[model samples]
Target: MGTEVQCTLCPTECELENHQVGGCKVRINRDGTLYSLVYGKPCAVQVDPIEKKPFYHVLPGAKAFSIATVGCVLGCKFCQNWQISQALPEESEHRDLDPDEVVRGALYYGCQTVTYTYTEPTVFYEYMYDTALLVRKFGLLNSVHTCGYINQEPLRELAPLLNAADVDLKAFTEDFYGRICGGRLKPVLEAIVTLREMGVWLEITNLVIPTLNDDPKEIRDMCRWLVENAGPDTPIHFSRFFPYYKLKNLPPTPIETLNMAQQTAREAGLRYAYIGNIRQSGENTYCPSCGKLLIERIGYFVKQNLLQEGACPYCKSSIAGVWDQT
Candidate 1:
């Protein structure tokens, strides 16, 4: 009988037989040993503004050296990076950059942090883990923009090394997760709470798709849950969803919907809520206590930051975020 290995990294718990790849399309079991096919092989690499990660609460106006491999655990229908996220390891061209090299690239580019983004970082767990260790040693921070689909054990192990995270909360309902994302909602929610408990500076992104998850009640419920579990200080970004990938049948999210979602987050006791993907007053950060503009941002660029040592200069209200690399 051939031996099999179970990948417990994510909730999917894909058990694979010899020579079979797991559901993530990156991990394969060979002779009872499981190996990551995408480790040290990232298909997407670049330097982006930290705001581009939609991380408003972490080192505002800093640059992040971003990297990602070519596979994901959950298949989201409206994935913006589907070209790389849904492709197999062998299907895309990748750079052979090891952990040390990744740290070197970050230093070379003058980045304050190394971000695992553009695709689900959980899919390249080993690579991200190793690089995160080196990133810390080199006096740089580690961040990830993930879908929050990871299991508890792996998330706990990785949390200490992670300085910040932006979890894509997709939607509030299990029906939406199962139908639109081909995954479950419970684990994602659990991961978010776990990230908060682990002392990681956490932000959330909810891509509001029209007619799918734009229901006001559902949005309110999600914001309330986030406030209750992840704390009222956690920043949430209500991003406008554009039709793409397998979800092209749907139109872009209405501007009013994004605004309403942000308003709901605030009403739910979330201190910092912002609208993303479109230019508006929501792109800037204001003091939750005094409502004074703390950071003025134009798209991904920070025009001015009036924070004095992570506090609102106007009202002296301390903001919630990793303001400095130290």
Candidate 2:
């Protein structure tokens, strides 16, 4: 192994030798040049409710045409979508769809948004970037479901085209990130700040695993950081972790733990904190000012919306989200 070339996309900054792929598995060094193997070859494509992205604040009940290629930068042990995220291009079933075709597919499906989801979109950067441009040109919104492991410069370039994003914060500690996810915490936190600063409608998901990252104090600290950096209005979803992938040995996150984490977020000055995976009243959106329910969601479907345009009817408090113009 000689003649190393570094990938500046994420903090991993994987330096690849000849014929070596980066940590993502999709980006490889071929004869000293870096190339993305899974470009335009999306393995998963489906139309889903925008709420399913758990982007509760953006385009409420709109349908999003979601697409994903193989590979991811982070290898979280409890990843539910590990089949696609951990697989290489050749290891997954994929279909050929260029940027233009992806835009067309969204229109054909009567979707208001195009989402890069199911797997980490950052590893399929080239494809997502190109498709995002076309998606904007077609007047369709662009969104991403990601792990938030990315560099600032690339995120800056990608931000303008993005209308919404649901980032998986995963955990609060560097110890948990390194030991459990094969990644770090700082870069993800940096990326979240970058996204928020860019005016992208952002939401965060933290998979609460029992006996791991379920500490209420640690969650409160995480919530405080988000409130300080991303704003108190930023929606935080503390998702339940099922036994999956490499972490199948661990028990699922308890409902009480998820509730405690949500309570911790609210106590830490967060305006919106939600519980996910298993349904409860926390799935709906309410006004932080008057305690009036603004949007009532039944699972992934919006059952009722009581907002007058974008603000709560009772209190007229401005909800921090892209509620209209989908």
On lDDT, the leading prediction is 1
Q: How would you encode candidate 1's per-residue C-alpha lDDT over 87-155 as one tens digit per residue? A: 988878999999999999999999999999998999999999999999999999999999999999999
lDDT of 2 by residue, 234-302 (tens): 999988899999988998887888889988999999999998888789899989999988889888999
- Note the residue pairs that clash in candidate 1: none
TM-score of each: 0.99, 0.97
lDDT of each: 0.93, 0.91
TM-score, cand. 1 vs. native? 0.99
lDDT of 1: 0.93
Worst 10 residues of 2 by lDDT: 1-10
Can you give the lDDT of residue 262 in candidate 2? 88
- CA error at residue 317 for candidate 2, angstroms: 1.2
State the displacement of the C-alpha of residue 90, model 2, in Å, after optimal TM-score superposition: 1.3
